[model samples]
Target: MNKKSMSKGIIKDILIVAIGVLAIWIGLQVAFGTQNPFYVVASGSMIPVLQVYDVLIVQGHEPFEDIKVGDVIVFNRPSGQDRVIVHRVASIINDDPKIIRTQGDANPASIPGTDFPITKEEYIGKVAYVIPQIGYVTQILKPPMNYIIIVIVVGIMIVKQISKKKNDKGLNINDLFTKNNSEQTENHFSELDTLEKDKEYSTHVESKPLDEDNSKNNSDKEQK
Candidate 1:
């Protein structure tokens, strides 16, 4: 491929993968019913159980009723505050709004200014899995860096797939060249056959006798 076409292809591939990342991220949000399905623990609030820079994979979009006391949960630090906090549910304060009392593992008491019963709407998800200290790397890959890394990953995935297909099919550049040569040979023979037919038609048309009736009459007159 020419340089221009190759560059276009690379750009197209990167865009496609970037769009895929966005789609998958949206899908995860819908599936988990929370925008913070995977959260990075930014604070030392959850201390011993969860440290700063630890990545937590919030499991399930479980209903509020299923949220139980003693379950380590992730919720908005303040209701609808857009801030997340990972704290252990200390008690079920109310069922009407499904309010729960939560306290950080390291803190002696519940955070001040946070209302008595936290609602289910404030809960993002429960901490089902944790990847310790990876949140630092995850945080670093937040914006522009993440996009670059995703594009690189997409390129690598494409390369791997191509290599795998090549291995599975046992195909090489020689095979491609051989196939092209065979096709060229077939086309050449086809052209030769067409030319031979045209030549035969030309010979047939040229060999036809002109004024056949006159020649026949001359022969008869000569014979008489």
Candidate 2:
């Protein structure tokens, strides 16, 4: 392969992998109808049902009224707090505020006052699916660390691709070995052919001399 061909092949492989990753992320976001649908569970509040580092897929399409008791939901924390929580709906009071109580499956009682019976305005969404263990990847690669890791991985991939292209374009060790072996085999065959031709030519030269001597001796004997 030439330099241009090798580079194009490497680029094609990288693009394929990149597109696949983007497709999965986009498909998940579009299907859930939420821009940020995946959440990492830091605490084991949901216990055996949902372990720590489990990723939650929240879908915003379901109406607040449709949320029934025992259904787990993700909602914004009450009052000045700017955090979200995922818990099971324990009760639903159809009032002006439309109270929706929620509690963790592991907790003995419903989540403390003001947070549980969250209003429709506080509701973020309902838990549509649970992806186990992948949240740990998100948790490990957070913020600056995540960016650094991405840069390092991209750098490594670039270096690998460049090296592969070079190997394909230039005579690498494997190519050198194969080329040398082919030349050596051709040389060996040529040497054998040269030796065989030399032997045949020498035999023809020696037989012609012997035949001439025999013909001369026969002519002399016939004359006597």
Candidate 3:
């Protein structure tokens, strides 16, 4: 209820959420047998089949020897850019040492070094699943936007906390006001009842003296 306790509770909740997220990430990694079990499609190279920002769930457990033509795969670029690429297998150059070629679905032909000479070492995994457009969320979390999002979230939390504190204070004030009104009402009724009792007692006392004087006059008349 106090400021310090509220702050501590918020911090504890944040830690719990963070830990839960980390645990899920680790579980996915172990289940998929890959350090990076997920990858976001950054380019339209695999368009129509794999759009830009499509989320890919890669399974590293797939045997490299099982790869064949037309199968979509994720691999490190053989040459330039030194980045991951998602493309379909154009051909299997060799089976002995496991060499292959890949080409983007949108491209006319496979680029020489960029797509060819894919060895097992460069192979990451097969595309196990595709989640449409979800990678855009990851993209949005990328630099300046992530910072902006954090600020917005923190601001909302602070506003909610302040609002809740104000509501609690308001409720307490209302209870006190109601108690005072109730006490005042009860005291007013008690005073009215006391006044009524006093009025009745005074009327009885005044009527008694008149009755006694009347009795004495009547007795004298009778005697005369």
The ten-residue window of minimal lDDT in model 3 covers 193-202
What would the per-residue lDDT of candidate 1 be over residues 1-224, giving only the tens digit for each residue?
89999999999998997787776566555655666566667766555456677766675576768988767777765634756667778888878867789866444345433423578667777775555565566556677766445434433433454567643321221232256478864564344423322232233223442368745765786699
Worst 10 residues of 1 by lDDT: 168-177
Q: List where candidate 3 sits over 4 angstroms from the true fold.
A: 142-224
* Number of the top TM-score candidate: 3
Residue-level lDDT of model 3, residues 95-149, one tens digit each, is 8998999877655446666678899989998876565566666556886544334
lDDT of each: 0.59, 0.61, 0.66
RMSD of each: 37.2, 38.5, 40.6
Query: What's the CA RMSD of model 1 in angstroms?
Result: 37.2
Q: Where does model 2 exceed 4 Å of error?
A: 1-15, 139-224
Backbone clashes in model 2, listed as residue pairs: none
Residue 2, model 1: Cα distance from true site in angstroms: 3.8
Cα error of candidate 3 at position 201, Å: 99
TM-score, prediction 3: 0.62
Per-residue lDDT over 42-78 for candidate 2, one digit per residue giving the tens place of the 0 to 100 score:
7655655566777666778878878777677888876
Q: Which whole-number lDDT from 0 to 100 does residue 174 have in model 2?
A: 27
